[model samples]
Target: MTNSWSYSSTDNLWKPPATIIRSLINCVSKNGNLLINVCPDGNGIVPEQAVETMREVGAWMKKNGESIYGAGAADYPTPEWGRYTQKGETLYAHVTDQPIGNISLRGLRGRVREGRLVATNTDVLICEYWNPEVQTLDGPEDIFFNFARPTAWTYPLPDESATVVAFRLNDDEGTRTERQRLDEVRMRI
Candidate 1:
């Protein structure tokens, strides 16, 4: 079953409760998208509160939309605090909560060319590399050995209450054999 609800404020500033935002994050984490609506006044102007809320939501999207839009789920040895999406040689990572820092993905065996913060108009952040000395159970590995500090890229929510961040992975040199193998395993199930 599906459910829906609505909120309205004639005062032109309608802030959905924090509970609502938390719910949204949870939904997105579970592979769901949120469709928020802000009704404009009869004069066709969105309420100030509504605008602020939108800005905040936009910030979250700017930072984390990559994982929500089309990220894939993979099991890793370590707990990754973000979600990820991939298209061909491009992989997107969405970091909803956490201070910006180097991100590491162990047990990865794929060729990665470069890493970038997606919302920042394709700014290159990390140059990808592979370590022949390390290997996953499958075989040779190409893990994100080092992720430098995240670029200054960030989505400033309209409300200015929080921020969201995203990163992209480029593997155009045919280095996703590990991902392909994982796909094969899923198909069998």
Candidate 2:
């Protein structure tokens, strides 16, 4: 998704692997799809740079594909830090930029049960707050998520391009089955 189809001498304009990873998550969050074109050389061979980048992307997918594989667009607005993707009641926050203070997700409706960093598979602090001053017409109890850094991972996050935090939410009875499945998966991990 970064460069031209055929090879050009100046087409060394390949995007970094991390950028591609972020783009993939963003596309999934927006209910879209990504098609990365691996440009071949004049001799009909893929470039080494492109191959390396794809390998890096594959490595990332191995750890965090759950956030993108079957996710749909989030119902709430995107937060300042990044975009969001959802599967049933579960939400995945794709943090693309480093926040100044805390990562805040606004206008959420479901109750969050648990949150964890997809890369590290470790817990991330998820706090809900009720601010009367900033209350919206949506409801008196406007859901706001204060995603704090967990002790398990570094504060600023090691991944610069994107860091994913998966949140298991409780919204409806149908989601209970999914929640139980997530719980079972967590237990196995």
Write the residue-wise lDDT of candidate 1 on 1-189 in tens digits.
012133344243344544345445545555565566656656787667667766766666666565455644423332254444444445454443453333344434344444555455444333122221333333345334222332222322322232223333334535446567456423522
Q: Estimated TM-score per prediction?
A: 0.46, 0.74
Please list the C-alpha lDDT of all candidates, in the order they appear.
0.43, 0.69
lDDT of 2 by residue, 52-108 (tens): 999999988888889889898988777777888998878898888876543555644
- Stretches of candidate 1 off by over 4 Å are 1-4, 8-31, 39-46, 56-79, 99-101, 121-142, 145-189
Off by more than 4 A, model 2: 128-154, 172-189
- The whole-model C-alpha lDDT of candidate 1 against the native structure comes to 0.43
Q: Give the number of the best model, judged by TM-score.
A: 2
Error of 2 at 169 (Å): 0.9
**Error in Å for residue 181 of model 2:** 25
Q: Against the true structure, what is every candidate's RMSD? A: 10.1, 7.4
Candidate 2 has which clashing residue pairs, if any?
Answer: none
